[model samples]
Target: MTIIRSLSEVSDNYRALFVDLWGCVHDGVRPIPGAVEALRAYRKTGGRVILVTNSPRPRAGVAKQIAGFGVTEDAYDDIATSGDSARVAMFRGAVGNKVWHLGPDHDAGFFEVPAILTDPAVIERVPLEQAEGIVCTGPFDPLADPSVMRPQFLAAKTRGLKLLCANPDIVVDRGETREWCAGALAQLYTEMGGESLYFGKPHPPIYDLARRRLGAIEDIGDSSILAIGDGPLTDAAGAMGEDLDLLFISGGLGAEETGTAIGGDPDPEKLDRYLAETGVVPTYTIGTLR
Candidate 1:
């Protein structure tokens, strides 16, 4: 792959960028070195930057967390979270509809419509027939019995209820540890013949929303936008599916340890070996975008 010593090479080629949050711009706790400056430089050159994250929280909440990390509101044009997209789908399809949630209560914010909220304690008391659709945001209790979840999925399927998945990722970084996500639960429900719609990375709608958010400030072409991320299944897949330039960050999903490369430029044989194993040939490779 092409080793870019500076961001200037791609600067003129793109008018806007949809930057990833966790590994690209910041760790869970803080911004990476030159991340703010790189974005500032891009903006100074008239490039619009949109921070796109797989955060399950609402966009407003995501922005607040970013601000807490010392990233000022002026650093980027707009921010979009997976929670926002899931909320969009819920409002469109399940308005005034009752929802049976299999995830945490924090995810309740996504269904803040006031009509869909149901207590887990009351799930056994309430008939499954009363629920509208199955919304899996994530596991309420990570250590909770997976077998206990089967009945919920089966009940939803038997009733022809819709399923909405907030985060498409099966796992995500929590501090230095990786934890399971709503997608894993969604996958289980899918195997049970339950119809489910997902929101987040590797989905076109979130990318489209991110594009629109960026477009408000400056023009961006599909060819000029670059997707920098660490997940082969979601971030990388999404970028490739959209046919955009991509720079894959290693070690996010253990791809650095196990993954193959695809079609890309000159790089070390070791890198080629890693890329070959991962099947995610990035335009560039780095330990971290910082």
Candidate 2:
């Protein structure tokens, strides 16, 4: 893999780009340096940029949060969020209406389809058997250990409740810390013999949504699309699975494993081994989006 400094070096090759949000554009707390500018620059040059995020929030909600981090709407042509995909599944009767929400209040918007029981007190009052299924947005607290929810998970599992994971990200960079996400919980539940459905990167639904959004802006084929992100397991794997080229950011989630600090040159040997283990070979590698 070749490491470059910015997307501008190879932006001309793709008509539509699927850009990851959390680790690629920002670290959850602030915008990554030049990340927003790089996307805006790509758009200015006639590229259709789709902010494909594993965030559990709906597209509007994620857009609002990213704007708080200085990411302007003009930075991308559109957004496709896991929550939006999950909402589509819910609308299609994939999951029942009486759902047990297993995340924070900020993510309760995912349950806006009807009466959402967000109150912890009220939720505790209702028996686990009463809920038809579970909708997990994320952990109760991003900073806390995921094991704290094991009891609830077991209870739901015992009741044979299916889980719909909105965000399939196991972990994400939160400023200087690594925080657990809903995918971790969903994986744990599945390990304990619970059936779970995931809607995000590394899954087909979210990518399908992103491709449709990009198609609306430009009639580009998969070969003319590039997926850019920091996580190899999510972004790289997703792009490779969808048969699209990938632009892997070396300094984000795989920094420690690849021995590439943020804004630093990636250790080629380590990066190669890491990609080999994940079975994802990116078409391009950059220290950062810019």
Candidate 3:
């Protein structure tokens, strides 16, 4: 893979860029250094930047969260989130009406529509057998161990309830700590023979929504649309699945296994082996967004 030191090295080739938010642009608490500037620079060159994220919150909520991290409005053209996609699916009756929410209060807005039944407290009190499906926006408490939700997941699995994972991210960096996400729970449910539907990265629905949004802003082709992100499972896999080129940020998630120290070059042997094992190779690898 080509190793890029900066985004400017290859920004000119793509017309529309789908940039991952949390790991690439920020660390959930603060903005990553030079990330916002790199996006601003790309936009100045007439490239359309879409902040594509696996955040379980709606696009507006994600935008608000990022803004607090110092990512200005001009950095990107628009935002698309998995929560928005899940809302669409729920509204269209694709995920059913009676739903049990498995996330915290911050993501409650994802089920605010009239068509879906998602009273957090009520759902928790009611038996899993009564709910049609489960909507997991994120872990009930990101700081808690994933095993904390194992009993509930097991209960839901026994009932044969479908799980709709709004965010397909397994984990995210909260400051310097790693926190589990909804994807981890959904994965556990799938392993236990329960059915699950993911709304975010490595899935087609979110990418389809992003493509339509980009198409409306510019006449772009698959080859000219670049996906920039930090996760091999989510970003790289999603880009390859969608037939889009990728600029993988090596210093983010999976950095330890790749032997890539934050803000440093990746170990070629380790990176190659990891890519081979995952079967998700990026067009290029960069140490950071800049």
Residue-level lDDT of model 2, residues 88-204, one tens digit each, is: 776555656667778888886775542222322222213356788887889888888888878988898898888889999999988998989999999999998899998799899
Candidate 3 lDDT over 1-290, as tens digits, reads 89888899898888889999988999988888889999999999999998889988877788888999889999999888888787777666654667787888878778655333353222221345677788888887888877777787788888788888899999998778999998998898898888989888989989887887787788788888899998888988899888899998877886887887766778888888877887868899887787
Per-residue error for 284 in candidate 3, Å, reads: 0.6
lDDT of 1 by residue, 1-290 (tens): 76554466656777777777876676678775566777888888887778877777787778888888877776788997787887777766642256666677666566554233343212211235677776677887754544567977887888787778888877766556666778778788788898878778888888987887777767768887877787777888888888888867664554336332221222456556766776776786654554
Candidate 1 local Cα displacement, residue 132, angstroms: 1.8
- 1 or 2, which is superior by TM-score? 2
Quick one: RMSD of model 3? Answer: 3.4
Q: Who wins the TM-score comparison?
A: 2
Error of 3 at 142 (Å): 1.5
Once fitted onto the true fold, the runs of candidate 3 whose alpha carbons sit more than 4 angstroms away are 114-129
Worst-scoring 10-residue span by lDDT in model 1: 117-126
lDDT of the structure predicted as candidate 1? 0.70
List where candidate 1 sits over 4 angstroms from the true fold.
5-9, 94-96, 113-129, 142-148, 255-270
| RMSD (Cα, Å) of model 1 | 5.5
In order of appearance, the predictions have TM-scores of 0.82, 0.92, 0.92
lDDT of 2: 0.84
Order the numbered candidates by TM-score, best leading: 2, 3, 1
